[model samples]
Target: MQRTDVNTLGEFGLIDHLTENFVNKQQTTILGVGDDAAIIAGGDEQIVISTDMLVEGIHFDFTYTPLKHLGYKAVVVNLSDIAAMNARPEQITVSIALSNRFSVEALDELYAGIAAACKTYGVDLVGGDTTSSNKGLIISITAIGRAPAGRITRRSGAKVGDLICITGNLGAAYLGLQLLEREKAVFKDNPEMQPKMGEHAPYLLQRQLRPEARTDMVDTFAKEGIVPTSMIDISDGLASEIFHICKASGVGAIIEESGVPIHNDAQLQALEFNLDPITTALSGGEDYELLFTIDPKDTEKIRFLPDLYIAGEIVAKEDGVKLHTKGGNIHPIKAQGWNHFGE
Candidate 1:
């Protein structure tokens, strides 16, 4: 037998190679892969389903992350995928595997966050499962949502010349993570020095610890009477999600660095970390903001929308994906998003 290493394929590549042989046999299975969420047939509307897993050491660290925030984030990430489809999340199922190190009180704290997120997002906690694990805590959340007829969006619908748009800001969450790691290292060396983050940068800390999905943006699109040409949520960074849209839609894009939204605090902290803010904005993951494209004809409707940035435009595939810098420089857009398989 020939030995194959999983890291060579990477996360997305491994998924593609593994599931390539699986067949979608049912008429109700509208989509299978290569998109944010799976589309399924409903009586009068389309049902969007998406699942995400957060492992103890891989996705999060208890040394710096609170249980409540972790639980909330686990749900929000999947809901963000639902929002990427331009759908409103309806319910979620949470499954947890924990080791003996956790107490019943710990589980209560986690569920409390899940309940709060459910209320905030206007969804119900339908059902889930529980199990034991020897390693550490693992959470898997599956979100279910519905979209109105002909309203659901996907990565493959973007058209040439479509305006690429993003909601809220980017890179703050990544910066927050960096800050937490630094503090964690300090605490490991000297346990007496506890990590206190709220005093300095509340906004950036919140963006990482407890990020809210852009479900409100889906509402904004509804109120504005605009359907995006295509859509994806920025979980893996702007450049990575852009590649998803371009590859799925068979188009390229050119985004302006000036147009990419970055919060003032995020930029300040990026400098503290000795990093370029724009680089973090492009490569940082877990912002949970939306990255979408709209038809140029309907662009006027969203012009007045708050915090909505028209960052770029979809171009023909031959043009290649590029980025225009604030200093009038153009370069190829590289995918530096989160990779589960470490390089």
Candidate 2:
């Protein structure tokens, strides 16, 4: 038999390859795969379901990540998926697999964070499973949300001439991860040395450690009477998410370099690390901000929305995905975001 490597397909590719043969047997499964969340028919409203898993040493580093923050982040990431569907997350089920290394007090601290997230997001902690693992801790959370029939957005709704928009700033969380890893390496070399994250540490670290979902943006859309033509949360970098939206919607995009939102602190840190701010913003993952497209007719509706950036526009698929750089250069925008299978 021939051997094939999982890394060859990457994460999303591997998912597609594996699930290609599965057929949806239920009519309620409005969406099955290849989206932020699965949509199901539910009487007056649609039910949106999203699940995410975080593995120890892979998704997070305990050296810098607190249990409380980890719990909150685990929940937030899944809820972010729900938000991507332009839905309101109402419940979450958290399942954990941990080794004996964790103590009862540690579990309490972790649940405290989970409780905090539940309270903050107004979601209920429904039911979940717990089991033991020999390797390390693992958390899997499933978030359930609700959306009106016509208002639920998906990745496949973008159309040509639609305005591409993003919520909040990008790249800070990636820089925060870099900062934490750098500090961790320094500590590994010299235990007596303390981390010097400088002035930007708080903001950057907070972004990486405890990211909040843009569920409020869903509310903003409702208040403004703007239903995005398409939406996806920025989990896998702006460029990658753009690719997802484009591929799903059968359209292309033109991103303006100047319109990409990079926090002032993120810009400084990127330069300090000898990285391009725009490139960092493009490729850095885990922003958890929403990337969505709105009909051109609805442009005025989003004009006054807070913290929103009109970064680009939907175009004919033949145009491909290109970035109009501030330097008067236009080039293909590459999807160089997170690849779980990469070494």
Give the candidate number with the greatest TM-score.
2
Candidate 1 least-lDDT 10 residues: 17-26
Give the per-residue lDDT digits (tens) of candidate 2, residues 150-237. 8899999999999999999999999999999999999999999988998888999999999999999999999999999999999889
Per-candidate clashes come to 0, 0
TM-score of 1: 0.86
- Model 2 TM-score on a 0 to 1 scale: 0.88
The TM-scores, one per candidate, come to: 0.86, 0.88
- lDDT of residue 138 for candidate 1: 89
Would you list the clashing residue pairs of candidate 1?
none
lDDT of each: 0.84, 0.86
Displacement of the residue 272 alpha carbon in candidate 1, Å: 1.5
Candidate 2 backbone collisions, by pair: none
Model 2 segments more than 4 A misplaced: 1-43
| Reference-based lDDT, residue 36, model 2 | 58
